[model samples]
Each structure stands twice: as C-alpha cells, then as structure tokens.
Target: MIADARRAVVRAGVAIGIGMGGFVDGILFHQILQIHNMLSARIPPDTLVGAKVNMVWDGVFHAFVWGVTALGVALLWRARGGSARVPGRMFGGALLLGWGSFNLIEGVIDHHLLALHHVVERLGPSVWDWVFLVSGVALAATGWMLTRQIDS
Candidate 1:
C-alpha cells in the first residue's frame, strides 16, 4: 500500500503534468504552430474576427491550465514533509502519467469527439491526430514503466 504522503506527491505530479501539457499545447500548437485554437474548428480562424475570437478562448484555456498547475503546486507543497522519503523517479513517473492522460483524454474529447480542434486543422482530421494520440499512449506507458521500476 502507498503512504499518504507518496499518494499526495503523485497527485501533485499529475496535476503539474496536466498543467504543463496544456501549456505545451497552447504555446506550441495554438500559438507557435498557428495550426489550431480552442475553437478553431467551430470558429474557423480564417478571418481577423474569427482569429481574435479563438484567441479569447485560448486565453480562457490558459487560465484553466494555470489553475490546475496551481493546484499541483499546492499539493506538492503540502507533501513537502515527505520530500526526502519519496524517490525522484516516482515524481517523474507521475508527471508523465498526468501529461499523457491529459493528452489522451483531451485528444479524444477535443480532437475526435467534439471536433473542437485538432493537432493540424488544415488537413481536416489527418494522421497528425492519430500521432498525437499515439504519442500520449507512449508517454503514459513510459511513465507507468518508470513508476514500476522504483525499488520496493
């Protein structure tokens, strides 16, 4: 059985992962790539007005990501007492697990199910979407493996 402190740390790590993942998506994909936005599919960021509107939604998404990240920070702070006892690998694994989870669920919900946006919108549901999901699975699997490697 896992100790309460360890569990808390894991939770915190996952939260951090989620926030970081969201940031990556927002910064890399949404902003830098100019590929998609929070509502690119629905809004179709072809015009200045549409782009601006998507920008607003992106801001909202960032705000929510900030909140999740803050929660993770708070959780980590609470578990500081066990910092010495917990292994670094555990934390790292937790982060990957969280990040991959975010990608998997978000990819499925936003990219496939809702059609809110995709990894690359120009192609309109192309191989990039599958690649995103597969990457998520790979991340999550690696994380799980890392966690399993911890010495008992």
Candidate 2:
C-alpha cells in the first residue's frame, strides 16, 4: 500500500511543479522577457490600453499559479503528520510529471485547440511550439520512468 506520506509528497511535488512552471512561464515570457502576454497572440495587446487588458489577463494567470502553489504547500503540510519519509526520486519524478503535464495539456488545449496563445507569437505556430510540446513530453517521460523504478 502506498503510504499517505508518499502520496502526499507526490501531490506536493506536483503542486510545486505546477506552481513553479506557471511562474516560469509568467515571469520569463510574460513579465521579465515581455515576449508574450496571456492574450497577446489573440488580441494583440500593442497599445497602452491593450497592454492594460493583457495585464489583467496576466494577473488572472498569476492568481491561478498562486493557487496551485498554495495547494501544494497544503499537501506538504498534511504530510508532516504522516511517515515523514518520502523518497527523493518519488518527489522529483512527481515534480517533473506535474510540470510536464501542465505544459503538454496547456500547450495542446490553449495553443492548438483554443487558439489562445503560441510559444512564439511572431513565429505563428512555428517550430518553437513543437519544441515546447516535445520538451514537455521528454520531461514527463523521464519523470514517469523515474517514478516507475521506485515502489510508489
């Protein structure tokens, strides 16, 4: 049987992964880099007013990321009452899984299906998007393999 501690650790890892991933996307692409906004691809937030609109979307996105982080912390806190020993591999693998899963699902649904945004806006469904998806697959696969090697 999988101990609650292990389960909690995995969940916590996933949460952290998701939160970190979101922050990476938001900070690297959205704010610091300013390569793309949440709706820049769709709405083309070029003007001051448009940028304000995109900022709102960005804020919403950050809020969601914050929530993911909070959930992860809660999971970790719960684990404190349990066995307290969580395998490093399990946690690491779960982190990769969660982050990769986010990229894969978000890329497919938002970029491809919903036409929300692309990895590179000016490129317009170029190689960068595929690279993003492939990277996610690679990370997730590696993580899954690592987890499988362990006894869960």
- After superposition, the stretches of candidate 1 with alpha carbons farther than 4 Å from their true spots are 82-86
TM-score result, candidate 2: 0.90
lDDT string, candidate 1, 58-100, tens digits = 9999999999999999988888764556668988998998889
Screening candidate 1 with a backbone cut-off below 3 angstroms (N, C-alpha, C), the clashing residue pairs are: none
RMSD of each: 1.8, 2.0
Instruction: Give each model a TM-score.
Output: 0.93, 0.90
Q: After TM-score superposition, what is the CA distance of residue 103 in candidate 2 from its true location, in Å? A: 0.5
lDDT against true structure, model 2: 0.81
Instruction: Indicate the worst ten consecutive residues by lDDT in candidate 2.
Output: 79-88
Candidate 1: 10-residue stretch with minimal lDDT: 79-88
lDDT of 2 by residue, 1-152 (tens): 26666677778988888887888889998898787788877788788888999899999999998999899888877775655566778878888988888788877877788877788777777787788889789878887777666654
